[model samples]
Target: MPELPEVETTKTSLLSLLEQTVLNVEVRQSSLRWPIPDDIQKLRGQKLRKLTRRSKYILAEFEHDSMLWHLGMSGSFRLCDHYTELRKHDHLIIQFEDIELRYHDPRRFGCILWLDQNSQSKLIDTLGPEPLSEAFNAEYLFQKFKKKNVAAKVAIMDNHIVVGVGNIYATESLFNLGIHPAQPASSLSFQQIEQLVVEVKRILKQAIDLGGSTLRDYSNAMGENGYFQQTLLAYGRAGEMCVNCETTLENLKLGQRASVFCPECQPLKKVKIAPQKAIKGSKA
Candidate 1:
């Protein structure tokens, strides 16, 4: 699925649409994860005013309403010349006076929905802070982790704890921090939590700069592939030698997602709580 960085790249490339009036819209296939809203055609004469991203969803603000777009497991958008030939799996098309935007998805898990100007989406309203935002500081994570007994990887991947730390980025971030993915979330110390915050922000920013990691079916609005996959230290390197230490990286399943880590670098500490002594004057 397209994560934050991938979504951000697409949003950035579509920035030129701002102040441009929508000329037409065609829904080749409305059977996506959800049906493309019939009212989407109402955008025909509205001007695109702003474009933003929340988690993996792109918010395109129009003069009247807005649209929420999600590029599912294999969905992408491309910019093309006016009347360019539509490709297979091209589910939706939005045209401007001089150009067109096409949405392609092989799996059809993506969504295109309309939003009222003053409405809030339940999808985004309850999401935690963006991983790179100031609100996602160490203190915030520390408090959230306190109540989570799940694995560190699972906790960080939770949308309520932090947004956009998907399986790929979460695995990579845990590996880079020398923290085992299966480590209990509440067991992480303040120092480790602090480092995790920094590492997640750094990795996410770096991925965005590199155009995101394209394992499969991911590309920018221009159809250019991401280069970050070439720089991965972990995530897909199961049974490969660790770059930090020569130990072979191992893959473990956590919450049904593969987590790759080096045993030598990220050791899962087993805390043993000592048994309490019996009371001195208690009856036998």
Candidate 2:
């Protein structure tokens, strides 16, 4: 899935479409995460006024309403001239006077939805604060972590706690802070939480500056792969030497997601295990 940086890069790549009128809207495949709204045809002749992103969703504002786009797993958008040939997975195409915007998703998990200017979406309404926003500072995260016993990694990855801190960024952020991925959320002190918040913002901003991690199928609207993957420290470097301590990095499953960490750098408090009762005469 395209995370915050990828979405932001896509938004930046789409500035050319601003103020351009939609000459036509074509949906070669109407079925996606949600069906392409039948009313999308109503966008024909409407001018695209602006393009912005909230979390992982792209918001395209027009004269009367806005459209929300999500680049699900393996989804991407490309801008091409009208003469460019379409590929197998180019599901939707919006034509402008001189260029075209094509949405391609081999996995069909992305969505394009129409939103009225005055209304809000249930999907967008419940999301937590944007990670880059002032609202997501260390003090704010500390308060939110109060009484939450979930793992720190899971807590940060929760969309309700903070948006756009996905698995890759979350793992890298925790590793940067020298916090064990499995450490309980409420166990973090105020100072640790502050460090975490800073590292999260730093990692995300750096990734955005580099376009984003192109681990798989991610690309900007220009079809260019992000270079941030080259600088990654821990996300996918399991069994490799840790940059800080030179210890072999270890991998584990946390909440079913792969987490990599350096045991020497991120040692956790040992949890006590109860002694097991001996079964009567077998092994003895």
Candidate 3:
């Protein structure tokens, strides 16, 4: 699945090229999970403004309209020649007057939603704060987890709580902060959570710079893709030695997702004692 940084990277890479053209978008395919009305009829000849992004969505605004695309797992926007050979499973295409933009998905989990201008705020209004947004600083996250019992990783990954902290990024963020993935939200200290906030932003920024971690199949707008996978400290290095201490990297199933971490680096801390029940003085 494309995380927040990956989606934003895609928007950044193609915005410059797409903003340069005043061409119409002709839809060759529109059978996604959501309706993709004739691309040309809806977006043709309209001047495209800057590309905007929210969460994992890429928003392309037009004269009075906007287009929403979600690169669900295994989905990519590849730029191919207008006359290039169309391969199998190329479900969507945006034909520019001069060149065409193609969407290739093997799993077909992606979505293409179209909405009128300024109407999108309502659709994505309830989503959580962006990880990079000012609203997501340490103080903000701490408030959300003040007395929560949920695992800190799951809490941060919740879309309604904070956007774009996926499994990979979550694992990486926890590793960077030297915090165990299974740590309870209520047990984390304010200082530790603050470190996590900083690491989250730093990792996301670095991933965006590299275009996003590309191991299986992830590419940028021009099909360049992300290269942060190479810098992964522990994400996919299960059974391998921890780079820092040479300890074997262990893998565990957390919330049904594979989590890898260096046992030494992310030491598990025991929870503090719970409050003891008081005598029934109120009933007396």
**lDDT (CA) per prediction:** 0.89, 0.90, 0.80
TM-score of each: 0.93, 0.93, 0.89
True-structure lDDT of candidate 2: 0.90
Clashes of each: 0, 0, 2
Off by over 4 Å in 3: 17-29, 38-40, 116-123, 272-284
Give me candidate 2's TM-score against the actual structure: 0.93
Model 2 Cα displacement at 215 (Å)? 0.9
Better of 1 and 3 by lDDT: 1
- Over 62-159, each residue of candidate 2 has an lDDT whose tens digit, in order, gives 98778889999888999999889999999999998789999999999999988653325577887999999999998999999976778899999999
- Please say which candidate is ahead in lDDT: 2 or 3: 2
Better of 1 and 2 by TM-score: 1
lDDT of 1: 0.89
